[model samples]
Target chain A: MLQNVPTRQTIEAAHMLIAPYIHRTPVLTSAFLNNLSGTNLYFKPENLQKIGAFKARGGLNAILSLTKEQLRNGVTTHSSGNHAQAIAFAAAKVGAKAYIVMPENSPQVKISAVKDYGAEIIFCMNTPEERERNVQEVIARTGATFIHPFNNYEVIAGQATAAAELISDAGVRLDAIFAPVGGGGLLSGTGLSAHYFSPGTRVYAGEPEGAADAVLSFRSGKIERAPYVKTIADGLLTYLGDKTLPLIREHVADIFTVSDTEIIAAMQYLWERMKLVVEPSGAVALAALLKNREAFTGKNVGIILSGGNVDLARLPFGKEV
Target chain B: MLQNVPTRQTIEAAHMLIAPYIHRTPVLTSAFLNNLSGTNLYFKPENLQKIGAFKARGGLNAILSLTKEQLRNGVTTHSSGNHAQAIAFAAAKVGAKAYIVMPENSPQVKISAVKDYGAEIIFCMNTPEERERNVQEVIARTGATFIHPFNNYEVIAGQATAAAELISDAGVRLDAIFAPVGGGGLLSGTGLSAHYFSPGTRVYAGEPEGAADAVLSFRSGKIERAPYVKTIADGLLTYLGDKTLPLIREHVADIFTVSDTEIIAAMQYLWERMKLVVEPSGAVALAALLKNREAFTGKNVGIILSGGNVDLARLPFGKEV
Candidate 1:
């Protein structure tokens, strides 16, 4: 079992356990982008992961860790987005009942996906307190285990495997790896992957300026609220947790904040040049690297494209469909 | 040098010759897509090709075949799309001058890409007749050789390599291979590849109902024009040439026509389910397969996603930016 924070052995074991359930997502490159940014960029496209996000990794790991008896009681999680789908998908895969607490305002596509996975949906008022309260009710009623979206050790260990694969597959001694910081699950997990697998490589983070909690937490050495939250990178609007913050503080070298415009431009370049369908949050790490290109000119950098769940009806780039 | 129709040896040789330049693009698959359509689907994403199209293969092969004596005068072609960019890019790579005749109303994105490649663009009226006239004028003035977009044997051989790569890369024996027909460059090449390499795999084509000339030609046993040319699948508008027509006629088993609505739906499925940024023309093959899903149930099918070069300002599924 993983402790408060995952160790190298736990993470490796988690990777081996979850190997059949997840894709060893390829590391993509664009020479045109490398030239435009003046740095060799390696993209680990988790956008192509099952359920269109790396949340699938954590969701699968956490669910898979449950005892068969516990799994029969079902699993519960509160997310109106990717984590909802991830939990629903993972639970169904293991023949466990899944009760998902979602905001009433969750997008139709997300709701449809969760429904398709045979998870019971418990809609709540669109607030953290309301969602958690609803999840507690589900737990009380069904004895469903509440899986934390990011703060759990088993989940973090699973997320770490993506970075581990990149380290092995990129075919270069990556100088640094970058990932978008939301609740710090992927970033901290990525940081630990570097710590254990490639000690020489540093891990940095990209946080949206609109929802810049991770940077504040990094400096203050504790979980902190964002000054404001108004970014198009909606997947990155949460604060880091106790378990995630400490790991990030210890393992992450720095945090760079980028504007929504910068993120959109990076996404456009990815769509046009690389023919990749990446969302705003997915493009944030590349945006941050491009913004600070001078600091690491000609260096090899690995970026984890976090997800691809853009609302086609309301694309960020143009007028609504 | 190989003559008229490319044999297995010539296609193999073309693959070897262009190995240094073109991407041996990966064959992608989606289990969700397979379940929905009731068929095992393998996608050859030529959209991730060098110039974002398989045209790069044909252009590079055709240009490389030109001797120094012929190349000094430069090469000319008439296209307002991927072929134009491919010719320019290939010519620029080999230090040869390229004169491209494009439609006066060519999309800004296409114009910018050609300009970026250092090609001399001569804009003509948006008609095949006018474009050919301008190509002739450029050739007469500069003594450059005119490279027909699809008619030339070398270009067909180049296009064939993408299908050949798919046959090699897609582990299971494919029951059928599908591609959209435009000038028939890629479809004919794909047909030849199947004929030589995977003899059991039947070749089929998807044509947009709006630009339904290829099916007309296949039935009539001659070159024929579409009754009307209007579809979001802009890449499949052109009719087949003499060389491509004969090859397609002999090798292809059937042709299926899909409506614009079907094409758009298939494109959306690819974007949402597969996380692939494919253009409407690129999605046409899958559209045809889905429309005729009964005929292909439980069969392993290969679809060549032809390109991913949509103008973001004018996406097919949404309101104009």
Candidate 2:
């Protein structure tokens, strides 16, 4: 299943194909944050990307890679977060219909975002089995191609473009690059890009402590799954894919887990100090860096802020920062 | 009183002097906002400026222009909002002591910001008269130079740099530019820049209806003070200065007043859709644009987001947005 991992060439090709569809989101740096962390940090703010996440790169790339026949049949995906909106937005852009499967318990904001992108919503029970079954039912009915959120080679290749841009834009070889890990799409792509674009740069993964399967898998030399998912960073609840695990093992240097409290604290800090509206999952990488400041001290570090599709009504830190 | 208003050349000189001290904040545009307002909007995000407000530009320029003897004597200002923080931060940067006079009723957050920048706080009664009296007393006692928040020519010239950059960076001649009128510092500066940099561009001022003195003054052709200020946009509570009024009369095309509800709604919209953490004052220009969208329809409009220094604990829209 992992025989053909995405290479630098594939990632470069994806960058060219998806360049017109996505925004080259700004790279921000804060002197205050740098002084506090004792490291020179550059932030790639994908929260400003179309669909408010780096997932837009993957979704558009995958949909565009499809043949005419596949496009005519349309596309299907199961996501309750940014990916649903990403696929929906990408499908709408290419004039292809999208069938999105989401849990009934998903927030109205997420539902409205998907609908606003001209996607058809299919509600399912709050379980992986139910979501997959509903997705299959939709795919069977419409003869649509299933665009996996992270596992597909095209998706991984597309996500790598962010790192490619970051390395080229920063114009400095980073000591390490940190990204939050969920399905491992962003991490694997970042790892591959760092390995190829800046060979001296190390790739680090930040995962929620509640859902530390990636860390366990890295230590055990095999894939592992979380017993139960309970984290404020809801985007990191998914398990890693076979396609992404191989790349992670080959290129990723370390995996760090941060508590939900730390993630929320980082999110608050960003909102108050940096004036950036980052979601919980988006702050996980920064949380990891802050928690282990000594390891990154005096080094030039790069961080990918994954997304900013937060539910304003249910902020984790209650009413105020 | 308005004998020597800041000219375009002075503004340009101020830009050069303060270029090393300030951040050339990014210009952001949103397709969603463009679709909603039916106008091509270019946002100059000064909310991301050094002191989290465009006030930093004015403060730094004024301090940098001071003679050695004046710098040795220190600087003084009476402001309970962004200007206080700006003066404090700028003074610290130039190694000058800052004597800040603030109302006793000022928020703790604002107080802390001034303190963090190494300013000495002098408390006064909540009324503007009392605040001014206290500032005079401090100036007399310390022989400190009084840095009027928006009335000074150097301060106005400093603020003009924002619009100068906007015109040059947008690379397009705007049909009009909008900015919140808080004592008319930013508005006058923007008007001057638009007049010189983009000659065809018109300048508009946005003022809160609750504190609509600027609008009344614009209509009456004389400086009119608000009888009693009561607006969510606390930053716009002051009356226009003698220096700023003449510039506004010469260059400003229109002044629009927006209700508090509209301002809060625009703030929420920016936070929810654009993922920008703009304060109520920062959203006033946008509120004016959104309320009267037809006036700006089908044209390229530039808006200055003045600041992002709000008390998160006392948000107007509450926790839910």
lDDT of 2 by residue, B1-321 (tens): 766777778988999999998988877888888999999999988877887899999999999999999999999999999999999999999999999999888888789889988999999998878988998898889999999999988999999999999998875679999999979999999999999989989999889989989987877878998866799998999898778888898899999999999999889878787777789999999998888899888999999999888766556765444
lDDT of 1 by residue, B59-130 (tens): 999999999988999999999889999999999989999999999999878898999999999999998799
lDDT agreement with native, every candidate: 0.90, 0.89
TM-scores, one per candidate: 0.96, 0.97
Q: Count the backbone clashes (under 3 Å) in each candidate.
A: 0, 0
- Report the lDDT tens digits of candidate 2 across residue range A1-321: 776788778888899999988988777777778988999998888887888899999999999999999999999999999999999999999999999999999988889889998999999998989999999899889999999999999999989999889898875679999999999999999999999899989999889999999998877767899866799998999888888888898899999999998899888877777777789999999999988889899999999989888866666655444
When summed lDDT is taken over every stretch of 10 residues in candidate 2 chain A, the lowest stretch is: A312-321
